[model samples]
Target: MVNKILCATRNGIGGEIVQVQANFVRALPAFVITGLANSSIQESKQRIQSALHHIGFHFPALKIAINLAPADLAKSGSHFDLPIALLIALHKKGIDTQEWFAFGELALDGTLTYNDNIYPLLLEIALRHQNAKVILPTSGQELFCHLPHLQIYYASSLQEALQILESPESTPAKTQTTLNFDTIHIGDTDYYYEREFPLDFIEVKGQEIAKRAALIAASGFHNILYEGSPGCGKSMIAKRLRYILPPMSLEEMIESVKLQALSAQKPSYTPLRPFRSPHQSASKSSILGSATQNEAKPGEIALAHQGILFFDELPHFGKEVLESLREPLENNELVVSRVHSKISYPTAFLFVGAQNPCPCGNLLSPSKECRCTPKDISSYKSRLSEPFLDRIDLFVQMQENEQDPKPSLDSATMQQMVFHAFSAQKQRGQSRLNGKLSEREVEEICILDDATQRILLQARERFNLSHRAIQKLKKLSRTIADLDNAKDIAKSHFLEALSYRYIS
Candidate 1:
């Protein structure tokens, strides 16, 4: 009989579960591993043999054929090392199957080592099959101990793992809920990056209009654009906004960690929102998803899912990257298609873009003289298409000022406003925030009274709002109404939403 053990792999955005099966026949004592194993996995034979010898166990002296079954699935990473080795040891030594899903890399000294794949892979398994019995390396035990499902066991060495397999039903000594943030008090914990944004919203002087727009954006996760001169607090306001944005749920925290795992960066288990600011020279492939590479990679937007994506000097970004925003900005997700396969990733993020009115960056500055010709200014503004501009829910133009120390709101005050709106959204049984309302949800939920409809009709005819823009306007109105603590969209709410349209 073939000995089979279970494991998982990081396939795409998530992962796939794999079965490692080993069968031996009376032939030459050769160890062969098959089924699309990548280079790291293919070279595991020597490491496994060395690990067994170091741990006082001998390699199976028979023709051992190790096959990763249902073999068509593409598998990668060194996380498979532990499971493959386990199958060989169990079959060769006449040990009964323990039915454990093992994942970890083996060191030549017979101890388990860390791989970045463990977090994302185990998260996928626990979510799919709760109550799973898993054996992982001790290095990352703290990272996953808070999992409400899976009964996880940590083994520090190959010798210890074999002892666990041989003696089933014995609980491992080192099992604790160290990764305990799953039940963490959201929004109140002293965060990992406590000092990320040093400046408060009150420090942003003489831009109450801009702060008002920021308030609405934070309340509803709305996409916002700021047109301002240099030193006009455009980037400053954008940075502070992340601190005041609403708290993330447990599910949002999990989604954020999984996305970070796909990139070179290690996954952070904090409830703090993501803030990504790609440089102006970054390519469209880097901004949006990339398919030309060997594997499809989730771009910055997907990485910014359930958080904020800020683009500084927005006009300097390429047209392709700007145009690609239409999908994620509206639908809240992106389907990256390759010739071989297609993968969809959730990208529901608040987008914040900042730009100067003219190429000289002094078009709006009161004290600075403008040197750029009218054509230069026109061409720079023309780079942003009307369709792209319409997707934005709020727009504010700012100019450099000497000082206005009188504060409008600090982070604490603004956070209260956001929390109020968030409470209102949830009380109304809304699964999404106001700005993310679908066309169907907007119509069904944001029912305008006769007076509100009159304001909307008058504005629609005067502005010649397109169907898409009108739909977006309703979303904006919904957010404004939520901010006012109103149960319904009144005429004032509709008018305020209309005032934010394409400012001169």
Candidate 2:
């Protein structure tokens, strides 16, 4: 007798269907599984056999050959245990086995267990197999419920699964809900912190121009660099800027959840904008996701999707590591190429970098005397290539202040302003903020008056701005105008945008 059960195998983020075919022939007893099985799939034979004996079912002492169909594709993971066991059981009981899909891990006691990659499997199953009934473990049912147009069956044990299959008409139907699987099942919510900009413009006690630049960066999602001596509150203000940024939309939230899942990060629901601070000693693979023999994982930039990727002490990082960000910074996606496959992960993050003016950390300090020579300062600056610097939209010089004052706008106040600005941008019938605007969108939204155009042209000549720098300036200026509720790009906005450019 022969029986077949439908199952799935996941490769990367996608899933492929594997038909588990069991043949009980009248010959010498031997159990075999073919179809390019990996170590994990090969090991499932023992797990399934042990689970069957644990449930008081005898192993058929016949030539039992199990074959995963489509003999070319590789099958991995323990998710095939349940389906293989079910195929053997149906063959033993002489039951029909062609109407349903089954996937789950099995305990030694025959209890159904959850598999780690079930979410992607469920998504793929829902998308590919519409008419087939899906039988997954009870614990994974909540995640699978979000998927529509499928008859889902929840199984707690091998015996229970058999009972449901034997008496399908007697089993009760389950109601489907509209809940989002991404938002549920997060173990820890308290550890997830949103960006809170507690230090306001008034609290700085000085550097009003820097405060204005910060506001523009937050409003437009533009990249900003703060270069000054140590203890200038550049780091302080940058940390707080996250709190002042606008909230994420539902689509953004979904993207964030997917990225976190891909990276195996917990606390999937993140209401606040993500602020990723990678250390100077971080590796290239950590910054950009690496591809392995089995899967490709998301890197820091992808994890910071739709949020901020902050690199403090910018020049201290490896030149190669810093330059690696050029592609993702421009394309909003990271392409990891391996010998076999090239996978692209979305990484649409706002870049914010902070650094000292010199190695001594006092080149621009008002009260401290600079100990470093001009050569040292030049060497430090040259470490960051011009191409990398040009990608930065705003670069402001922070000056040390002696006084410490209360913050002008707390997180709550700044969040309100940011929300309002975001609302205004949306009112323009475009969901993208200023920083994310395409060149055509930039030309459409950021219309400069004749006087403002002349000012930008002069700045372009005076500052020796590259083509990329000019576009970045226009985008930043548009964000500033949006922040102030201004109808057009004014000269002041252009000046504010230009002031952020890093110059010795």
Candidate 3:
């Protein structure tokens, strides 16, 4: 007897359908699996046999052979355990089975264990088969409640799963009501409320110019570089910027949740934007992304999709790793090309970098004397290449004070202003925020006066700005103008935008 079951496999955040074919015949008693399975998958034979005995089910004494079809693509992970077990049961019992998708991990005691990478499987199945039944572990039941129009069977043990499979009529079908998997609303809870930003512009006591620059960076989703002495609040202000940014939309939230699900992180359907701060010692593969023998996994950038990717102590990162971000930063997606497969992962994120003026950290201090030579400072700055700096839009310098002042504006007030500005930009036919606008859209929306244009041209000549940098400046100026509710870019906006240019 031969039985086939449908299972799902994920390849670099994308999903593929796998067919598990099992055959039982009157031959020498043995178990075999084929179709380029990895070690973990090959080990499923022992797990299945042990789980069957623990569940008080008898294993078939006849020759048993299981093959995962589409034999060319390599299959990995222990997720195939449940499907393999079901096929074995069908072969042993002579039960007719062919219509469901099964995925789960089995414990030694036959209890079902939660498996990672269920979201991609669910999404792929939803796209292919509309009325397919998915048998998942009961432990992960909550994760699927948001998905609608699919039949879900929550099984706690192997015996329970066998029972559900054997008696099709007894299984209760999932509800047909449409459910939005995005936008988790929390009423009267801390999860719903944005966190209070401890560091505010007024509290800085100085550097009003830097404060204005921060506002523009936040409004436009522009990458910012803050260079100053050690005691300055460069890091402090960068951390607080998220509190004042506009909330995420339903589409952004769903995309983020999908990435989180792929990374095996908890998916929260909340409005809070993601913030990723990786250490400088992180590897290129970990930061960018790497391919396994079978599938590719998302790295830090993908995890921070639609949010902030802050690199504190920027110069401390490896030059190669930092340079790898040039493509993803420009294209909003990272393409990991392996010999066997080419996988692209979405990595649209806001880049925020901070660093000291020099190795001594006192090169730009007003009161403190500089100890590092000009050679030393140049060497330190060169660690961040011009190509990387060209991608950054806003650069500001922070100043430290002996006494921090009282708060000027709280997160709520700042959030309101950001929200209003965002609304105005959207109303102007610029659907996305300033940071994500294309060249044509930027030119369409960021119209400047003659005086502002002259100033930008002069600054472009003096700073030797690249075409990309000039466009970035225009976008930043547009964000500043939008925040002030101005119809066009004024002299003030142009000056502020120019000040952010890296001065050698």
Candidate 4:
């Protein structure tokens, strides 16, 4: 009789259920694992054997075959060890079978080890099988306790797991009875940073117009670009922008955590959105994700999903790396393709780029002279493609001013405005931020008044704006209207949206 056990595996940030089948045949003593499993799964034979031996169950002197059913599916990761060992143990004891989903790694001493991938896999199973019960290492119980629906059993060792399976009246797993939406509210919790961020907009002494642009970007989740002289507070404003951005909801937090769980980074339970600032020297593959052999991994853009991706010194970044962002910027997702596999990941984030107006970093400053000729400035600006610039909603040019100016909108005040805008978007049933609206959604939701339409027509005719640019302008204007809680787009909204367009 063949013994069977249930397990789960990864399929490019997604999860798939797998069946482990064990059989004892009449032949020379040998252990074999048959499937499209990689080396990580194949090496589990030794770990499983040792773990069983440590628990006083030696394999019988017979040929043992373990088949991971649906064999065509490729299996990777060390999580196969626990399920394989359980199947073999039950086979040796002539025990029939029980429907249970098991996933973990088995140490040589028969201890169950935790793997971070369980969160996503278990989440998938919970959705597909509502009454599913999963057995995992005790260390992971707290990590997934927030998922109240799934029944999760945590065990410390192989001995404990076997005892629980053998017992007729084992205690049921503990679950969270009450949701924690109100506990540790986003308004009360600090942002997810290691240390206190002492740099606030107040520290940025000048460029009042630039500060206004940053506030608007945060309120609507719009992408913004800053070009000006070095030390003109471009990067300073970008860094502080995150502090004033709105907090995430429970659903957004879960989605963001699911993406983070796919990467090697330890998952965070906080509602604070992620902030990723990849250096300009990063390769295209590193920023946009890649597939090697059969394993597909997420890149920095995917890591920054549902958060902020700030690029300082934008022109210094690789051209290919910058261009690769165009698709994700428009579609709110990234698709990475290899010779044999393709994987898609969420890339919805607020982009903030800062760069100097020219190579000399003094072209727009009145206090300094720009040594670079017009050709140098033109070439520097050309590094950012026209299509790429179109995707960005707001463009501000900053210059060094001799007079010190007081900051108008502080972080707390700006965050409140963003929070209000977020409420408006939620009431409208938009699943995404205002900046990520599709063209169809823009047409459906962004209704322009007659006066606003006239202004839009004039701007398009005078600037020779493309159809795509007009669509983007409508989305931008919609966000501006949302900020003011307006029922319709006014002339001021249309004019403000037009002012952010590219300047020749």
> Candidate 1 regions off by >4 Å?
92-99, 171-197, 292-294, 402-405
Q: Compute each candidate's TM-score over C-alphas.
A: 0.93, 0.84, 0.86, 0.92
Using lDDT as the measure, name the better of candidate 2 and candidate 3.
3
Q: Candidate 3 at 226: error in angstroms?
A: 0.3
Please provide, for model 4 over 189-258, each residue's C-alpha lDDT reduced to its tens digit, 9 standing for 90 to 100.
3222212244577677767878878877877788899988888888889888877776665556667777
List per-candidate RMSD values in Å. 3.0, 4.8, 4.1, 3.1
Give the candidate number with the greatest lDDT: 1
Which 10-residue window of candidate 1 scores lowest in summed lDDT?
186-195
Q: What is the lDDT of residue 460 in candidate 2?
A: 81
Give residue 89's error in model 3 in angstroms: 2.5
lDDT of 3 by residue, 100-211 (tens): 8888888877888777777667877877799788888888776665554578888998888899888858565465232232222323211122545555545555556666
Candidate 1, residue 453: lDDT: 87
Better of 1 and 2 by lDDT: 1
lDDT of 3: 0.77
Off by over 4 Å in 3: 54-56, 92-99, 127-131, 166-208, 261-270, 402-406, 425-431, 447-455, 486-492
Task: Tell me the lDDT of model 4 at 14.
Answer: 79
Clashing pairs in 1: none
